[model samples]
Target: MTNFEEDISVYNFVSILGECFQNKASVNLVKHYPTGRMLAVKRFHLDKIWDNISIVQQEITLTKQLQHPNIITYYTSFVHGPEVFAVSPLQAFGSCKSLLDSHFNEGLPELAIILIFKDIIEAVNYLHKSGFIHRAIRASHILISASGKASLSGLHYACPLVINGRWQRAVHSFPLSTQPNLNWLSPELLEQNLKGYNEKSDIYSLGILCCELANGREPFADVDSTLMLVEKVRGCIPGLLDCTTLPSKCDDRECQGDCDIEISLSRRGFSQYLHEFCYMCLEREAKDRPSAAELLTHPVFTLVNKGISLPELLKPVLPLSDKVSPNKEMCHLDHVLHMSEMDMPSCDWDFPIS
Candidate 1:
């Protein structure tokens, strides 16, 4: 607080480079005029801040307590007038959702997903050990650091299970504005029943995250919310799409395509281990899902190429340092890179991949 150089405020940082999707519209990208350093400053709306002040304070307190390499920590936060500014480092690649929008529309490579998920699961494991549940764990909440580290953020919805110094069975409260995360939420959380839900709910969301990363689209994209909810409760599970799961192109109605089911490992798209992992994650009963720590031991993670770095797997996608400027125009021009558009099955979540 003594030196102005260490301080970040509206006066020192100038202009909004881009809007941050982490907390919807509350965070903005600001650049320091002299050093040309960019950072995100989170500012809640004055009118809405009063209504959600408890949640805001809870997020700040939780961030200070939850320290992990994979979790996002703030540089400093101070109140200026009616707004509170929480400044943090600018992730070079932005949120994974941005990546899906600019590049990698057909999902990221398997190695890249492994690298990112490993970091995210580590964070989730830490939170679970600390008796907290990160209600939001979707791709949109994940950011790729300049050094290829994945950071789990958007902690406003995170809540603690330890109340009155006692570990509770489950939490009955629902997350605010649940619509955006409806597709990824566990059935119990959506059901809001007296039985309640526990940290296992987050594991279910994590499973949906895998499917999202692998398939390059939401698990229940464009489906009716009411119908999706009903199906999810009735044991409808989404999966990582690949040749192993999808029916053969040559569909003989009479034969029912059952005879050609046995395919070589080389011809199959994703490995059997991945399918099994997803199956465990998407188990209809919350108790059936594996814990974050348990999931880390799965063989699918063994496929991670330890030899190659995450940045290498993300070829042709330049980090901010590689770019000339933060200008949206310069960053979005897709002239040099060529991406393969995945011809994913256009059916709904009910698509019979068998």
Candidate 2:
């Protein structure tokens, strides 16, 4: 039997769901015959794993160690020849990216953004406490389960800040195979300097995510990446768009996507609390960024209604629980411009001899 057949026969896997993250992996819907429970099986084609098979091994190992409600639940895994399968709860609503593509093309309502990011930030806090840097955090990496819970996925790029019982102040190397996530990456990480970067890098990325959900597109996404990098290194900040921030017109589309705007000055029709929160996350200096724990208490998040329900917020677009079917048609990878095409600027850094 082929690896997939062997997997289906052994684990009762069924219904090939769809692909995600540039088609590098595919998600399968499986029903556990013993309990008749449903699960999401992520199959990784080892050949497509950028860094040998070790990274997939690292992902599985790290996922097993995590046990937060807002984090994806990893059940088990098995290596069938060159393919590795990771089983988890099926997120019927799919990824936040898919939601953006299907329902909220004009960007999610601010309240919805709050509810979603609340879960994401809490998940980040958990990882930070565990001494792990989630090097790749973005909209697409967040999946919404049948309960309307947003769980943080994409631990494949995560790494430890604690090395050999010592807490390392900085991580000199960037996570490999994160080319598609460059826009969401922190500037300090892109700088690739000797000083290296720390957990604050995640904060910067979080700020970018705030702008992404608020504006319906990633901040600075319309421009060439090299220019965006230069802009970021030079301290240009992206912010929330509104009637005030957007230019009168971009011919047909609104004039958007320049990273140079100041976040603090924006009165962009959005709540001031949220505006300040984004500003705090996008601080030019990494040290100026707040920790994940600190951000959880921000008034922007505190303002959310006590009775907030993601399922209630997302009514017309209900979960895919009614039936299992292919979702690749709406996975939203088309607009994800790959950074591998961009020429990377030279950086000076010392390579630690292993």
> Best candidate per lDDT, number?
2
lDDT of 2 by residue, 1-354 (tens): 112232544455554555553555666566665555666777676778655467667777888788999988667677776667777777888777777777865567788889988999999999999998887887777888878788888887887899999999999877777677889889899999998999999999899988888776788887788998999999999988875765533443332453224332233467888889999999999999999999989989877887978878776788865665445222322211122123332111000000
CA RMSD per model (angstroms)? 8.7, 8.7
In candidate 2, stretches whose alpha carbon ends up further than 4 angstroms from where it belongs are 1-7, 10-14, 47-51, 247-268, 325-354
For candidate 1, the per-residue lDDT at 286 reads: 91
The 10-residue segment of model 2 with minimum total lDDT is: 345-354
Candidate 1 regions exceeding 4 Å error are 1-6, 9-17, 20-26, 31-37, 248-268, 324-354
Model 1 collision count = 0
- lDDT by residue for model 1 over 189-220, one digit each (tens)? 98899999999999999889988887677788
Clashing pairs in 1: none
